[model samples]
Target: MQLEEIKETCPFCWSCIWLLVDPSFDQIYTEDCSVCCRPILVKTTISDNQITLTLAQEDDGF
Candidate 1:
């Protein structure tokens, strides 16, 4: 698993954060924000050696 560090902003508190992503496959998970402790939905897509990440509220899209 190739790990990469990505700089991103929290969807809730808008705080700057660092996330680790594995560019080997697509994945979806939930994590709490370090600043606000709110649950966040994390989605990662891998294609052509590139990774795309999306962050949203945990309850979103339901």
Candidate 2:
């Protein structure tokens, strides 16, 4: 599916990073933090024609 680029803050490091998101529905993906070099759990959710994104800590290595 086609995706859109969005900017999100790294939950661990509070740094900015670009995210590719699926606009149709919620999605979970892993991406490493550019500033801290740690894995992040990137979550995207859409509701009421609005998109919400979040980042969290990931235990599994990527």
Candidate 3:
């Protein structure tokens, strides 16, 4: 498994944070903000060895 580091903004506190992601497969999960400790929804997409990360509030879709 390959791990990549990416920068993202915390949805709760709006702080810049670093996240480690595995780009081997597409995934959707929830992670807590390191600063505010709020849950953030994470969507990861892998394409042609490139990883894209999307961050949002945990309750964004519900």
Best-fitting candidate, scored by lDDT: 3
Whose lDDT is higher: candidate 1's or candidate 3's? Answer: 3
Q: Model 3 misses residue 54 by how many Å? A: 0.8
Tens-digit lDDT track of model 1 for 13-62: 99998888888889999888888899889999988888888999988832
Q: What does candidate 1 score on TM?
A: 0.89
Better of 2 and 3 by TM-score: 3
Clashes of each: 0, 0, 0
Off by over 4 Å in 2: 59-62
Could you list the CA RMSD of all candidates, in the order they appear? 1.4, 3.3, 1.4
TM-score of each: 0.89, 0.74, 0.90
Local accuracy of candidate 2 as per-residue lDDT tens digits, 1-62: 78888888887888888877889988788878878888898878899968898778897422
| Candidate 3 per-residue lDDT over residues 1-62, each given as its tens digit | 76888998997898999999998899999988899999999999999988888888998932
Residue 9's lDDT in candidate 1: 94
Q: What's the lDDT of the predicted structure labeled candidate 2?
A: 0.82
The global Cα lDDT (0 to 1) of model 3 is: 0.89
Q: Mind sharing the TM-score for model 2?
A: 0.74
